[model samples]
Target: MKYFAVFLPMLNEEKSKQYRGDHIAYLEEMDKKGKVYAKGRFTDGAGGLVIYIAETFPEVEELVKQDPYVKIGAREYEIHEWDMKVTEN
Candidate 1:
């Protein structure tokens, strides 16, 4: 599987907060399925990011398309393949 980084740029904060519960549920489900590795909002409040493990870009794209934020048009997103990881042991 390849790793993907999803960047969500919030379009409407009020709307986003309203749907945040649903969005969290979606992410939790993905996490249970092992499709999500990590997720969080940026410190500046611009938006959030989700790290995904999927076979292809289309696979990740489809996942994002189902997000509550996306469904409500509360955010726009960009997805990029993450091909490398570094860790200090």
Candidate 2:
């Protein structure tokens, strides 16, 4: 199963900046574990978004919960299980 995590950095830019390093580290770990598929921030002056491919929704949820952004209350996330039918190589 695949999961899509829609992360919205709340009005806590300062906190996000403070924890950015830890957050990136956590994301790198996830990538190494082959759990992350595609991830990027909303460079449109918005928030961020991340997509993960996992064994289950619970696994993805736990992963998201471990993010420094979420832990530090700098961002909140909404997760949805996905059924992807197409992709660009």
Candidate 3:
């Protein structure tokens, strides 16, 4: 599996709040499926990040498209394949 990072910049704060619960739920669902590596928000509140485990870019892209925040236009995102040269042991 490859790591795919979805860098989501907050767009509509109100909309985001409205769907925040659903968003987290979706991530948790994915995590249970072993589809998510990690997810977090920036302290500045400017955006958030979700690292996904997938075999192909399209798989991650599809996951992102299914995100509640993305589906509702509460956030804008760019998906990048992470190099991940280092990590905690």
Candidate 4:
């Protein structure tokens, strides 16, 4: 699986709040499907981040489009491909 870091910077906090529950539900659903690796929000209310695992970046992009945040235009996302390094020295 490939990893992607989704950087979400809040665009409309009010709108985000309105759809927060749906957003969490979406993530939880993805987690059940083994799509989400990790997720969290910024304490400062900037936005949130989600680490996703998928076969390809386009696949991840498709998943992101389903997020409430994206669907409602509450935030903007920047997707970065991540390469995890393991140390077994």
Candidate 5:
């Protein structure tokens, strides 16, 4: 599996807030299906991050498009191909 980092920058807080429930549901569903590795929002509410493990970048992009935030244009995403080496818990 290859790692991907999705940077979610909130473009419209109101829109994001309006769709928060659906966004969270989508994240939870993906987590349950093992598509999401980890996710969280910034403390200041600026945006969030979602790490994913997929076979290719296109898979990650496709999965991201299904997010409510992206679907509604409440937020914009910058996806990066990531490489990580874990050394500590």
Candidate 6:
């Protein structure tokens, strides 16, 4: 399985706060299920980014579609399929 990074460019601060808990819960579930390798929010606090390892693009897309932000239409995402060229550990 290859890794892909999904970038979410969010807009409404109020809406994001409203859905924050649910979003975190969802990410936790995904991580537990081994769908998400790692995830985090931007330092500037504008949006978020998540890295997922999956079998195919469709699977990645399906997982991303489950995000609360996407469901509520509070944010939009750009998905980039990545090839891991190097790792220290």
What does the lDDT read for residue 55 in candidate 5?
92
Clashing pairs in 6: none
Candidate 3 on 64-83: residue-level lDDT in tens?
Answer: 99999999999999999997
Candidate 4 error regions (>4 Å): 86-89
Per-residue CA lDDT of candidate 2, range 1-89, in tens? 66675565565888988988998898899899888887888876466888887888788888898888998888888888777778779
Predictions in order: lDDT: 0.96, 0.81, 0.96, 0.95, 0.94, 0.89
Number of clashing residue pairs in every model?
A: 0, 0, 0, 0, 0, 0
Residue 46 error for model 6, in Å?
A: 2.4
Error of 5 at 6 (Å): 0.2
Model 3, position 27, has a per-residue lDDT of 98
Give all TM-scores, in the order shown.
Answer: 0.96, 0.86, 0.94, 0.94, 0.95, 0.91
Model 6 lDDT vs. the true structure? 0.89
Between candidates 2 and 5, the one scoring higher on lDDT is 5
lDDT of 1 by residue, 1-89 (tens): 88999999989999999999999999999999999989999999999999999999999999999999998999998999998668989
Query: What digit string (tens of lDDT, one per residue) describes model 4 on residues 1-89?
Result: 99999998999999999999999999999999999989999999999999999999899999999999998999999999999787998
Model 3 whole-model lDDT (C-alpha atoms): 0.96
TM-score of 4: 0.94
lDDT of 6 at 30: 95
lDDT: worst 10-residue window of model 6 = 79-88
For every candidate, C-alpha RMSD to the true structure in Å: 0.8, 1.9, 1.4, 1.5, 1.0, 1.4
User: Which window of 10 residues has the lowest lDDT sum in candidate 1?
Assistant: 79-88
Local error of candidate 2 at residue 46 (angstroms): 2.2
Q: Which pairs in model 4 have colliding backbones?
A: none
lDDT of 1 at 7: 100
Between candidates 3 and 6, the TM-score winner = 3
